[model samples]
Target: MTVGRVGKEILEEADFNKFRQALIEELVRKISRGGCYGADIRQIIEETLREEEFVNFANKLAKIIEKRTNISKESSNEAACQLVEEEIADDIKGILHGQLEERKGKSKKEKEIDFMGRESKLWDETTKRFIGKKHGLKDIALILKEHRLMKITIVTGFILLIISAFLFNSIYKAIVVGLTLTIFSGDSLRIKLANVLGGLGGILIFFTSISILLQYALLEERRSMELKEMARDYLEKAKRKENFN
Candidate 1:
């Protein structure tokens, strides 16, 4: 999926992230050149930390500083880590702010140029309103026509379904449904109705087959139980006769 343009430059997902990181690194390097310890730098860092976008960059920069300087991630060095984080964050914010301001200035200039070439029409407002009203009426007519077609399609599908269920076997019903769908499937409304009716028919057939199989299974189970009980009774009567003899 393509991400929309940021200013005049279009950026994909990967490129956007890379751009953000590069901007942050470049800003940090620029500030570091001016000597990393100053009141303005501290203020910038504090402001950058407040912005949500720079939080991850701040953390990563702090870790890099610790690694390079061999500082332990202990309570004693926590303040130092925070200072480093703030310094990087401040630079990133400054660079981003400058870029945003520059884009705004360019956008304003482009808009002014565009406006200069446009002619002012005295009756433009009335013309636009009339055109809009005409389009709206056309849209309403189209919507009504779509609804009427859908209703007709639904009625036809239902009639076919009822006829297939009563006059034919399951295979014939399936074939009828397929033929009816093929006949009416050109329009969007007809296609949707066909799909819905076909799905419902399939579900009903599945359940009907399952119910028949379940009934057969239950009947067989009952017959087996009855035979076992009869055998047990016969054995009891035979033993009684033997005892009596």
Candidate 2:
């Protein structure tokens, strides 16, 4: 209730639109400041209204405030802004509810700037910096990171290819597979689809490379067996020489 707006269902139920639509500006003030029983709210109301608007704002609030206490007059701008703050709360809820009803699928974040009491400039700068970074790749490291996320998932696959080669010792296969998979990276939909197809091709390339590596490993295994046999023959000859001695 203090932060969120009242939904359309409650606003319609309360019939506030039917009764208070004509008194929009006045209602907005009362709802914003949160009507209090003290002079604080009254002072804010008095300060906010002009000579002409005062008559209506006061007259309108008098009827509403009189429900609990007699309407108090405000003498300063500060008092008026505060009073308006309270007045706008209910009206804000009503307006928000109407918007929600109209836009059934979307929700909005509420932003209020209390310029009188806060440093708005600093916050504005920070927000701008954050938004800027999100929309574009500003720095080298970030660009590299972004490109890595492209449809081909270039960064991850490049890493994967490097790892496969280092362990398996096939530079050519690594280069081929890395290139095949890294083709799909871009900040676009069509590129993402292309990346998928490219990845399938890369997978085929990967399997072929694995097959080649397996054959190499088998050749190495056969060469190892031949070396073991030669070593055994030398050891047997050395054994015969020791037995004769």
Candidate 3:
């Protein structure tokens, strides 16, 4: 799609609000799940809002709420105006209750630390629950391990591309090879980019790769059409020859 059309669609306020509402509803549903904890809720919110569309909607909604509620932009205590907290108060309470119940068998000190960890900040408290001290490190390791194969593939592909470019002594050929590799490796690129640069950046890379692939597809399509026309001409000539015979 053209930039102008994308801009127009993104700027539509009604659509933006609709997306925001949908996002809010999804968060509520996730939070209300049985055995759901504050950490899970935070994860849900972070992953959902990571999308460019959702992020844009959130920023717009926050500004609108600030204006409507007369909350000063300079005020640091605007968490109360947050869409999730405002719209899903009961659901949040339920989630908190579930979390509390889950911790029933733990020692008082453990429970206190967990509560204090979450109470440090509203959103932070909700997501920063006690999953054990080593949980944080394990989470990081798991994330890296998940993308280990993709990283290896990307490195191997680039090395091969570089070697081929050197052997052929043609930068143009290398570029075409690189684009082809990128087009086919779109999923790996998206996941890596999102993990490294966040959701919006990943999306940008994904679309850029798709655009390049589309160009390649268009070129092939044109070539196919030309070949079909040529075959049609050859068949016509052969038919005329047969009739003449």
Highest-lDDT candidate: 3
Candidate 3, after superposition: displacement of residue 142 in Å? 30
- Please, what is the whole-model Cα lDDT of each candidate in the order they appear? 0.37, 0.37, 0.40
Predicted model with the maximum TM-score: 1
Question: Candidate 3 — which residues are off by over 4 angstroms?
Answer: 1-17, 24-47, 74-81, 91-245
Clashing residue pairs for model 3: 118-125
**Could you tell which candidate, 1 or 3, scores higher by lDDT?**
3
lDDT at position 187, candidate 1: 53
Shift of residue 179 alpha carbon in model 2, Å: 6.2
lDDT (10s digit) by residue, model 3, range 192-230: 432323222334334544554564445445433443344
Ranking the candidates on lDDT from highest down gives 3, 1, 2
Measured with C-alpha atoms, the lDDT of residue 61 in candidate 3 is 48
| Residue 176 shift from truth in candidate 1, angstroms | 6.8
Reference-based lDDT, residue 167, model 1: 37
Query: What is the TM-score of each predicted model, taking all chains together?
Result: 0.27, 0.21, 0.25
Give the lowest summed-lDDT range of ten residues in model 1.
123-132
Give lDDT tens digits, candidate 2, residues 78-152. Answer: 322333444344443343232111111211211222221122120111100000011122333433343343424
> How far does residue 146 in candidate 3 sit from its true spot (Å)?
35
